[model samples]
Target: MGYLALFAVGVTKFLLGKNKNEQIAMDWRKNAVQVFRQEFDHVGCNSDAQSLALMQRSYSEYEYFASGRQNVFYAEANLSLRKRHCLFTTLLFDLTSQTEDLVQFNIPLNLPKNMPLEFLVCRRKDLKGRVSKLTNPGNFIKNPNSKHFKLSEAEASSKNSLMVLAEHDEISNNLIDQEVGLVLAKYGSLINLIHVTDLKQYNNFPLFLRAELQLTSESEEAQYTLLGLMLRLADNVAAYRMSQTVVQKCEKSRKQQKQEEQMQVKQAQ
Candidate 1:
């Protein structure tokens, strides 16, 4: 349903084009469509990215707000962090439906209300099927209350989504980081896109993606913890894009193969 709305915006934009300019500009169209038609689609980004960039720029300029949406989120410090870049994701909406005079759409990201340190991770290789130096599945427990409890290898392997005991440093590969009452990080919810959300504003991508990070101290730099998260989001995006490419290739191959088979049958007849 959402994708259909975005597609409609793209079609509308193609009919009514925007003037290419130096200032920040956003439109309802797929800004890359022209380049796509010319086979140089990698040229620019869409309106969604532009809006996000503007929001980021606003934070860079004013840099302060007592409360409301502009409040200083600790993760915003990551914007100046080393070896990292700002990453934002948003929901795409059509502007056409909202106004008759306006020809653009609005894109807003579902920013986290608090700094959550949890994100989801799929099992790369089942421990039961393979042998390695990694910790045994049975030796770890996910809940802080059950720190000493051990999960059986049989029980762990059978489950698809294992609740990662994230807040505790003892058990790593945590999918959710919960300390006290606040959630720090979390993986994707039940949806199509993979999500990495936090409780505080993620001005840049989170850092904890490389390693399982459970904050031991309240003073720890939240910006750095999110770095690993940002990297992991990149991995997820890359994997999703690769799957799309593979699917396109398979579709083309199937079409060609079908045509060839039809030709052969006609010739035999």
Candidate 2:
């Protein structure tokens, strides 16, 4: 059979019948407890929820929550194979803020500060405007506090020179630049892990650096890497907000806690 057919058969087999699917899905709910763990009693990926809750493809988004200084950050993605996303990664970070979406900065290995680095600023078209120079430091790159999600892939874990190929590879997503953007710069630290995208629909959430894996490779590293990034992002964002920010912080709201407990009731029904 074809790949698509094989995938469907695999899912059906894994899920079994509707009754059995519910059992498996319920297990997802139980494991949904933590998308990422916390060092302290009240931090980490406090929640890990899959779309199987509703079993709807439209809702096939994974909601991984990380506590921030002020609010909860959600790292979402759809692992559905039906979607024709090349390499099939649709990771997005929801800060749950109103920050307007802008620029999709495709980073390079070595980024110098103050020099002209081609930045695809906020302008939606046929991906027009061959650009140069990064003006908005907040978006392109920002000075991080002592705390930031250590993106290992961008550095070593995913192998050194991880970004050496990113500039050349096509990130197949609507929010990414159709073409690569590289330029010179000066006085910029290597925040090479993340690239900003303009795909704003989920409340001004900034998508973070994804763990890119080969489409042909069936290794679970991609999943692990994606989750790791989510956790790191959660840590970085939460830490940044608490330290550099003054707004409200994510404190494991009572409502959220109750909802998690309610999941057990939901499974019973």
Best by TM-score: 2
lDDT by residue (124-208, candidate 2, tens digit) is 1211221122122222221121121223333323322222211111111111221111110110121223433222212234333
Candidate 2, position 159, lDDT: 24
Per-model TM-score on C-alpha atoms: 0.19, 0.29
Estimate the Cα RMSD of every predicted model relative to the unseen true structure: 20.2, 18.3
Error of 2 at 45 (Å): 17
Every candidate's lDDT: 0.28, 0.27
Candidate 1 residue spans exceeding 4 A from truth: 1-10, 13-160, 163-269
How many Å off is the CA of 138 in candidate 1? 16
lDDT of 2 at 29: 31
